[model samples]
Target: MTDIPPLPETLQFTADGLIPAIAQQFDTGEVLMMAWMNKNSLAETLATGRICYWSRSRRSLWRKGDTSGHIQKLIELRYDCDADSILVLVDQSGAACHEGTRSCFTRRLEIDGSISEAETAYPTKIDESARQ
Candidate 1:
């Protein structure tokens, strides 16, 4: 069994009372997605062992995989040196993107500032059936 670390005290939230949280795959070290978390969501994430994010558009607590089944299980949580950002290590179950991709960062930028999509999409087909 491992000891649970205390939540950092110096977290610096943005003006809207949110902190940028980055979710990364624990085993593969792949960046999953970037989301915002308010104090309530952050505390809930720690307490529940599930990743919870504050949805700016919906203005509610968006528990990952709750709707789309792309859940992110919290493995570890870390804060940046400035305490303005958070890193969430997680065991991702399904595609982390709404576009049915493994990662939300599938787009790439070239030196000339051109964008390109990844050749291979993970989990194969894009599932848009979850959308209403």
Candidate 2:
């Protein structure tokens, strides 16, 4: 196994000390979701091998799938060259979006200025408990 690199101190968080994190399916290359992460959440994810993010609404660390059972297991973590954004390759279980969709990007904007639903490989697995 290759040694994982430590989180670089050069990461550029926003004024609120948060960085945008994009989660993608490691094998399929499907983008699952995008969320925010503070330093603490990022550290926890790296240490635990599970996906975690900073919840702006809750003002705390949000562990993905903790309530919904749609956990994202970390396969790999990467930062952009600018060190302002993050990419997390993961093994996702169930839905990755709060709406119980496989991905948050289930819609597309047409060239003619209309919106359409994009085709998803998997059906949505709605979890009612996730809403709470």
Candidate 3:
């Protein structure tokens, strides 16, 4: 069996008591989504083994895949060097983006290194609608 490491002590949550959390697929190492989390949501997610996030717009705790059944199951959680962010390795089911994309990084960068944003759009034949 493997050990799931505990949340680190140095994570720097913001003034609003929130931290940036990035979810990545454990098997594919694909970035799933970026979300915020308060202490309560983080603790609850750890306790339940289900990914939870603080939705800034909704101003509430968001349990991943609660509505769409595209849940993210926690495998491990890690902190970056700055301690101001979190990386959550998860077993993702279905899609991660709210629009129903498998990953939040479906965009490609230009040869000049310009960044582009892309996400999935479910319920039809469409996969992505450009964010830029």
Best by lDDT: 2
Error of 1 at 114 (Å): 2.2
lDDT of 3 by residue, 1-132 (tens): 123446677889899999999998887777878999988788888888999898899999899888999999999988899999999999999988876678776776654799666553212243355423
The alpha-carbon lDDT assigned to residue 94 of candidate 2 equals 92
Q: Which stretches of candidate 2 lie over 4 Å from their true place?
A: 1-6, 121-132
* Pairs of residues clashing in candidate 2: none
Two-way lDDT contest, 2 vs 3, winner: 2
Q: Taking the tens digit of each residue's C-alpha lDDT, what string does model 1 give over 1-132?
A: 123345577999999999999999997788888999998888888988899999999999999999998888899999999999999999999888988988898887654799888743233344588444
TM-score of each: 0.83, 0.85, 0.77
lDDT of each: 0.86, 0.89, 0.82
The predicted structure with the larger lDDT, 1 or 2, is 2
Cα deviation at 23, candidate 3, in Å, is 0.5
For 1-132, candidate 2 gives per-residue lDDT tens digits of 123337799999999999999999999989889999998889889888999899999999999999999999999999999999999999999999998889998887665889888665344555888557
Tell me how far the alpha carbon of residue 106 in candidate 3 is from the true structure, in angstroms, after superposition.
1.5
RMSD of each: 9.5, 9.6, 7.8
Minimal lDDT window, size 10, model 1: 118-127
The deviation in Å at residue 103 for candidate 3 is 0.7
The TM-score obtained by model 2 is 0.85
